[model samples]
Target chain A: MTLALPAAEAARELVEPVLREAVARLDPLTARVARYHFGWADSDDRPCAGGGKALRPTLAVLSGRAAGADVERCLPAAAAVELVHAFSLLHDDVMDDDPVRRHRPAAWTVFGRSHALLCGNALLTLAGELLLEQETPGCAAAARALNEAALSLMAGQALDLEFQGRDDVTREECLRMSRCKTASLLACACSIGVTAAGGPASLAGSLAAFGAEAGLAFQLADDLLGIWGSTEATGKPVLADLRTRKKSLPVVAALTGPTAAGRRLAELLARPEPLAESDLHDAARLVEEAGGRAWAEAETGRRLDAATRHLDEADLPADVRAEFLHLARFIATRDH
Target chain B: MTLALPAAEAARELVEPVLREAVARLDPLTARVARYHFGWADSDDRPCAGGGKALRPTLAVLSGRAAGADVERCLPAAAAVELVHAFSLLHDDVMDDDPVRRHRPAAWTVFGRSHALLCGNALLTLAGELLLEQETPGCAAAARALNEAALSLMAGQALDLEFQGRDDVTREECLRMSRCKTASLLACACSIGVTAAGGPASLAGSLAAFGAEAGLAFQLADDLLGIWGSTEATGKPVLADLRTRKKSLPVVAALTGPTAAGRRLAELLARPEPLAESDLHDAARLVEEAGGRAWAEAETGRRLDAATRHLDEADLPADVRAEFLHLARFIATRDH
Candidate 1:
């Protein structure tokens, strides 16, 4: 999850401390649980090295800079977005019952579901606290945008859960879920910085559009990796999404494709037992043969182009536009 | 439960519509789940008549009026506190794995755990959104106070979960958890109206103190009911908390009481098997004989007195103070 672009790496470095400070404001027990969930600490409360990719925070800071605001002034918005992201991840793991996250046991696995759930709640509240800390002119708008994104994120999660175990899920439904679950937060992340800086709403809208497209591209790439990426690189099992019978972009595409291969893939997926390694491989192959993989790859490229177009239309400073373009490309092409 | 106080009934009528409006602002699916959880809708997604007691919102509106703010201006703050209360109940039911709420199947029981959990998240985010809706001078402060209260509430829930299945939980620990889990939100509900109206901080503090005391008294009464109240009255199984071996205030008091009956009660509670109907009766008898009921009753009276004192210290208008006093008394003595 290394940042390929120097600007992304710089934004990550700039935002990490702010995130740490914001999380530190939680009560001691919640702070400890949150630190563990963020990979900043271990079960024994000892320090750890690993953390998230910081993509949302980086987008926030870069978009702030692109909107003609100082990067330092965007730190709270950056940290706030990251908190919301972390909150979603914590709850998502509980909802998905995922045993692992970030190359380690998931927070729910380590701290129990109750603790993880409450930690998520605390983080969500803390995000609001962070957004209002400075009393800036843009704080109200920023808070509103963040809350709207949060609500959309939860609605997306609910839809995702509803889509599970249903064989009739449409590709359109999957795409909508992806947009709501992933793109909404990313779009907010892109816009929150500008809003926090009191920049023009028009610029914020363009950056949000850019971020939304980039987010879709990122999710499409992720869906591909979930089936095809190496375990070493992705830090997850091979065909992880298929193993859970997740109705992700590729699976939905395969399930609903107009081909005999799609029917066979659905038949294979309908088996009641846990998917064996051989079954996973066969499912992945069937999905690729059904044109799901190709469709996703093409969609990723389309979204990336749309994202670049939005960035260009934003009319940001040349260097900032170039940096955002680099990050968008990096997201579309990243292996993990 | 019926509101015995005219002020409580009036506040409910005022705040219920506001809460419905705030919830309506959520995306359709999330809003459906929220309305269902609040008992405003049935399992078929049609409208229903029953709902919560609206204690938090009532407190908020009354506290605002006591602070000299128009009740209309306090609607958003009132609705926001109710949302927070509903959010806690949704999550708490999941964590407690309780099957009943407001005399019906719990939201998690009816809508499933995932929907309930995500709905709770959406409601919480909606609370912040509602708080920020009016852009009042005290919006930032109101949002801050709400978030802080939410954090404490989660921390208290975390502690409550930790205390489960433990035999060594002290009375002091139980009381602290009660305050965190219940009193914090009540206090926030008391203060948010004043903050939202830009009233004096001192009045807010006094009202919050009053609410906190009343909250503890309410919880104490609830603990007593959990052991002694009939199923018909409490809308729960008889001795429900005892059946779950909850470390509630009365149970903790009985467990730590310096009486021979306390030791006898501890021995009875230590049985590994689930308590039978006869055992529940014995447990209730033992608790009363150990003076747990007497102690809780005395404590509730003390808290009610302290709450009235705080109300007196708040220097509110005479009629408003009388209304608040009536509400507090109703909470402390309610049968359901």
Candidate 2:
């Protein structure tokens, strides 16, 4: 509650230019795709301004600075993390068949799956290329982190997709899925920050601890928003996850819970047809009634607290630790 | 015909260890995927008989050696190119929906699309990582070349995919696609070889020329086998491209040719359902009647000759260009 950190300002200053320079250097075709994803330009190489929040890159650069590293020196690593995040989003939107993104048409809907696929792949390659240009041990270190993060993201997505329509989803499974899908990348981001500073191994451990806790809290907030957050606040329909029959943590908990709503939730899930808006609202109410909402919110708060404690223990500069303090609190509280 | 170039063999020797060493360093999950792609292990992680031709890496290493660079020094660069080729194949199969590859189930099919996708992406990162190591300027150079190749591959694939439904695919378009999908990597191969050798820019130019020619010849053989060869010969069905209505060189040529079968070829392609096996056989016959196979085969021979000539003109030690020489002849003449 007492976040006195300037994470947003620190991130903006650290990342904006590195991203600019990275895209500027791409070949014509790749640059076009890179530019498009960054909201820096359109498909035809014209400039635009709709790219989403540069969250991962910000985490990366800040982590570096927090670890006593020159943020500028680690810009490529930061850029690589951002590129990887963008690429993942591009493909994920397609696979999920989600049409709108960043308040506009998703890449697949606009350029078609073929071009979207290419653009996604190009970002993946471009990220490595960015890391590949770094001096000394940074290139190899960044590449390793990025590779692991990518693999985990894919695996987590696969698990999520696999859980679709399966009523037997366990709490443990959802936790594992969340860890892979969210924590791995955050962990990677923190690791990249550590790499930037050539920080001690403890930095790696500490940042990952912060990242893991933040990641779990972030997912909890996402689930909470799915059911109860405002549409403007979340940029998605309230209870969109329920409408789509997603096996979110709250939903899974409610489905298997011992309450009147729990049995009804199971029956509704069994219905093959798309849920009506009224049905979605009822489902959210049922999940909340089954204590899913309160449980998730409490867990989120606990994790955020843990993350802050880790930041305190990380031995980073007080000012830099303050930034993580703000970010961790923000993660638990964000609507989207 | 007189390749006698020891360069290719030396390059091969240099590449295997570098690649093996890189793979040895992979984290458990990544190592699993890496081994599968390298042909050292199967989808389930069981040992396999062969991995690949290792063509691209060999080209990089050999070109460097032939260009008078130290073969030992260029190992990572060579390995990087090999990784790029493997990465491309993994993604290409997914895009094409090809079920089988490398004498096994396509990586995507075996591992599921999500896992396959990540695996390919991880390999791509590894390729850049291998190149970006501190001791090697070739890392950055290879990264640039590999990225260019990746872009070209995507462009070529897009063009190839787009060409599928269009009856008006031109010879020039097909040729350009070939250059992008095939020649660019090969050209990168040869160019990287020289870069490893610490090139004169002139070395890059000549090597690129050689690569361009060789790559064209390489694809030409593939074009031929796509129509004339059997599954046993090519490990894929003969007339398979036509069956899938792929806008391959032979198919494009037949469409443009002035003949009765050419007209019928267009007519059949216009049909909505997939071409029946019997219909595919007929389509193949019609392409022959339209002189499609002959034209493609002739082009293969011509390009092979040109590739050999480039090596000869480079006037390197007999062994330096030897592998490429053999590879060229093999591409033109192999059953597959």
Candidate 3:
């Protein structure tokens, strides 16, 4: 997933060192947990470059720059957002019983489950402490954003948990849960970025809309890949969500409608045992046949359209606007 | 435990309502977590008093009064400490896997462990948010204290988990863990009370020292009960720590001595099998025969002495001094 320049390149220069130092600051045990989970360190705490994609921090820094601020000044804020995102992923992996993350064993798999929990909690406190270091409007906005985002993260998590195994879940419910589960935190991340930069008044509103829509698009893309992408590309078994009984947007949309494939899905859901290896292909066929694939693609395109509209409304310098537009388009269309 | 208040209580008429209101202002879910943990709400979120001894909050209020501040002024600080304590208890229950809390099923046992985790995290945030409502000198001190205590708590927790299976762990290691796990937070709580009171310049040192010793006393008493208390009194099975191979102070001291009883205990440790219920009696007998219990009692007394010395050094008013002294005596000597 190569991103468009100016925004992405400038963000890379600002975000990498800040993230590196933050991970370095973790005491030995914390560092080990982070390094292993982020693929940066091995089980023995030795450092490696097995780091993450850092998409969230990139968005933060790029948004800061696009708002006409020196993106470097917002490194702490960007690091904080990334830390929070990583922490959420750590916990989400546990909550979702996801064994593979980025093609490696999840943090809870490497460290003991409770150890992962403590690491997540520590990261959260560290995030708060980091925010306390920021000056004026930044500190104030960060505190608000961190707490609000945490609350929304919990709500999103709860909604996801609530959706598990429920075959009759509605598309609107899936979309709403997606907004809370995925979009709110992303939107808050962008808002905090702009807030740290003392962003232009006109840009905040549009940037926020763009972030929310971007988040929705991202989730839609992810759900689509869960069913349709090849394991080589996504590093996940196709129809993984269906196997886990995850009520993703596509699956719920299919379950809500009554087509020949939908009836087969209903019959499949009636089974009490785990899906066999052979069941995945059949499940994918039924899901696609019931319009799950098309519905998800349409939703993805719709959300991407709205996100672009918000980027246009952002009133950035022409070059910055072009950069944001390119980046948004890349995120919406990325394969992995 | 019973407390001997000053002959004439301080006029603390105004603070209670504000504290109540601050707590009431919490989100409904947060209030539910707090109220349920406090025994003021049932598992279903119906209203009921949680009924555990609100010992920490009482200490905060009385300490505020003794320092010449109106109790009304210190209620938020008092409530904040209780919230922190509640959060600790919520997490501790999960870590320990203790099935019961306050004569009822632990939060994890009732609400499920994940929800318990979320509840604990929420209360920690509430602790910070509640403190922010009143910007007394206590605010920064309390924030710093809570942050430090939380960090120390995690350290102690890490050490405790690390020491879980080993019987040869040193007494010094146990003491260090105890200080981090129990003493620091207690001292922080007491110091925050004094800070909340806007007390005389000379009083802070004594309050801190007093708090630290009192905390050690609290842990000592706790260790004693782990070995000797009845199941009904402790709300835990008899010799629970012994069965778990906890490297508590008594067990640590005995293992080091290698006395006859210690040797026998060490032999049992090598077995690495489930301890029979009958073994608890023998474990306690061996621990006593190794003189571990006697040493623990002496250490408890030493800490009580330190606390009393600090209390006397403060040169508090006769009535205030009497109340604190009585409380300390009760703490160091309590049977349950």
State the lDDT of candidate 2 residue by residue for A106-158, as single tens digits: 76776677567777887777677677656445555667667767767776777
Which should have the higher lDDT, number 1 or number 3?
1
| Top TM-score model | 1
Error of 2 at A41 (Å): 5.9
- Tell me the lDDT of model 3 at A98: 86
Native contacts, share recovered per candidate: 0.79, 0.31, 0.13
Two-chain complex of model 3, DockQ on C-alpha atoms against the true structure: 0.32
Cα RMSD for candidate 1?
1.6
Error of 2 at B331 (Å): 1.6
For chain B alone, what TM-score does every candidate structure achieve against the true structure? 0.97, 0.91, 0.90
The better candidate by DockQ, 1 or 3, is 1
Best of the candidates, DockQ:
1
How much is B4 displaced in model 1, in angstroms? 3.4
Which segments of model 2 are wrong by more than 4 Å? A1-48, A67-74, A134-140, A165-172, A191-194, A197-205, A252-279, A315-318, B1-82, B102-112, B129-144, B190-209, B253-295, B312-317
- Cα TM-score of candidate 1: 0.97
Worst 10 residues of 1 chain B by lDDT: B1-10
